[model samples]
Target: MPSIMQRLNLRPIVLAPMAGGPGTPELAAAVSHAGGLGSLGAAYLTPAQILEAGAAVRRLTRGPFAVNLFAPQPSVQPTELEVEQATAELAPFHSDLGLPPPALTTQADIDFGAQLDAVLELRPAVLSFTFGRLTARQMEALRERGILVIGTATGLEEARQLEADGVDATVVQGGAAGGHRGGWLEDELADTLALTRAAAGSVRTPLIAAGGLMTAGDVRAVLEAGASLAQCGTAFLRATEAGTSAPYRAALAAAKAGDTVLTRAFSGRTARGLRNAVTEGIGQPLPYPFQNALTRPMRAAGAAAGRADVLSLWAGEGVAQGQEGSAAQILDGLWP
Candidate 1:
């Protein structure tokens, strides 16, 4: 049997699987080249794109690389009310871009089955999921193939659930993390959870702390609290090799001295990002892919025009703590 360390090569530091732009082939290869396990955030890619990136990484580095996906967020009703309310929330950007209102026909369109089939076919070294839990049959299929599975949990109950689902490890995403809060429980679903305590008290699977972790001390603090590793996404966002846009990299650096907030204006899921007009003034939109799609054109236009206000700009509450440097240098800081 492969030991846990042998399975993941037990890299104490892990590269965060950032979707959209940051998870480029160069970034993944560089992290793997640096001896840290790299992760390609294949969540947004079509199956073909995911396979292409994985094959490219294989050509560049002979090391462990994880493939991450947003484990199919729950579908929301695709109704006139949902669409009108959601698209109306996007009007400011539509006006700014001088374009007709987007005529969105459907709301939810995430193809989880296709993505899973891609995972099964590609068979990357590790497979990790976010957003929510996996079905028993899905978990069993991956296990049968010797694929190591990691689950994200935002709270105690979620962590326990991950353990029950047979995940080899659980990413203890702190409440302060960027992107989405994958907490499964109600009433207790605060926007976020603190990392250290969440790691120590809940699920026994090896814990990898996420959110607001910007420095080596931060990684150590989580490990001391019982985590086995630390996954730092925001810390690497501005790194030289990261796939973040010029505007985003610049904005992230500029926002480094400012505050971050959790808002659903970007993608319907509450993601932490810099404080901006779009986030603050907006009403709730269509959920998940609908909200994501509704804002896609705007996000594209904003980035093209260097307008940070309309872009997703997803980061943890610790945006102020983000460092500007190379991925290897960032890894050294986190690991050393």
Candidate 2:
């Protein structure tokens, strides 16, 4: 059997699926065309949108690419009081954005099964997931289709679990990683090198090191530590093809390495982003999806008006290393 890297024909560089708005088909394809594996962060996308994104990437490159989705978590039904409190906290921000009062409803996340069906149909070179693990049946289905499955882990235990669940590879997301942390257990954090070494030592699956990796030296360090590839997200945010909002791009340009914090204010899930007013004031909001929905209008308005304070400026600890250029240019700089 071919080694995982040999099978994928990867260039020791993998583009992290940034999800939400920053990840775009054009950006994914551009990176893949450059000999790295491009990935679409499809966690927030509907099934139809996932297919459309795959089509978009196909139009741009025939190289192997990956699509990532969030593993399903049990629904957390917030108390009416919880919803009201979250709404009240966000109401002022909504008003400041010239939007209506926050009115939230019971919304469902995109069906994971449906999303998997679409992914299987599109048959991207790889399918990766975070936040949780896939069941034996899910893994079996993917394997039967000859699709490689990758899972994200933040610690050794999670890495072992993914190996047991039959993931072909795993991404060890370090604390310096931007956006959502990948550990599904409690919030135990470690830097990229530590987690990568730990996972590589503990799991049989090939490891992909992620988080805070900005330069070719950083990539080399992780590979030397036993990672088969390095996946980068924040470093690629400024890529011209990325769907990063103008305000986000500006924030990245202005941010220093330590200017970010991990907070649940934006989406009720702990994610790293540049320190802004929203991350400062908002006390604990509702859980994910709910908090994410409650703040949607404010975020949308913030993006429209180019206001950094109201948008979810998801970035890794390596923001200072990001530069404005095409995805291919950014990849060359990171790998060369």
Candidate 3:
């Protein structure tokens, strides 16, 4: 089966899926309505939530869209030793927030197999993954259901592996991309511009360049570098209909918000975000899920309290390039 890239007849632009509610059904549908592919970040949702989000997008438009999830990695539970290491680092933040030292049990147990089953049942037009590659069985199952599988890659070696693993295409993520990177190959993350073009140089699979992409010029450059399409995440965070919280929106708009910073304090894995204080308290971060879970309460409380400093505020270095508007308006700039 041809990949969704071939099937959709879409414009050479796609709104990349970002986890943590930023890529909502409304945002996805809006971008789809604007003639680019829309997507849902199902990594943080339950199977039912994924189904609901997918169904909502379907109701909004028949234009092809994408469903994205993180390939399940071994739950890296924080060792008591490691937890002590990170927690001590965060003691000051705890004091500032007027809270007790975070307990170690803070973790989420998302059922990955169930989520995959739900994804197959929903049968989205495109199935994409990040953080790591998908298993052969998982790829085959999605293919059998007529879903196009797209793997995320950080460099040329990963792109090569995705093709060898039988994925239909690759979302070539660069260092500039916000949220978790797809670099599984150690020391292989070359510069986004050079790596994305190089990854596509030898692969027959279509390439989708993602990262630090905001303006029409950036879009044109990626296409010129040989990407068949450009996938942008931070560009949509400021869209009016996006699920971005007010603090996140403001952070993106902040004059001081310069290039994105890479920190794992929020989720235990490195992700780019607008530089902020929460990331500054990174020394005490537990491992994935644990650090993510430990800080969940604080981030929620802080966001509800309108505290921008405590939020993850993920975005790329080109944050200064963000503009407040609708998806269509942003697409006008991206595709012009």
Residue 59 displacement (Å), model 3 = 1.9
Ten contiguous residues minimizing lDDT sum, candidate 1:
186-195
The digit string of per-residue lDDT tens for model 3 on 1-336 reads 225556874677888898886999989888888889888888889899999999999898888888898887777666779878877776666777777876666346667788889999999888888767778898889989998888888877888888998887798888878788777777354567887778767898888888889889998998888888889888889998798998778777883545468888887878888777877757656667678877777787777877889888888767788888989899888997
- Model 2: runs farther than 4 Å from truth? none
The collision pairs in model 1 are 175-192, 175-193
Clashing pairs in 2: none
The superposed Cα distance between candidate 3 and the true structure at residue 185, in angstroms, equals 1.8
Instruction: Choose 1 or 3, whichever is better by lDDT.
Output: 3
lDDT of 1 by residue, 1-336 (tens): 224456665457778899998778778877888888788998888899888999988898888888999886567666898778777767767997876786575434768778888888888878999988999999988888888898988777778888888898888887778777766564243332354465566556887778788888887887777777777788888888888988787778878544688788877777778888788878867677778877788888887888777787888877877887778888888876
TM-scores for all candidates? 0.93, 0.98, 0.95
Give the candidate number with the greatest TM-score: 2
The clash tally of candidate 1 reads 2
Best by lDDT: 2
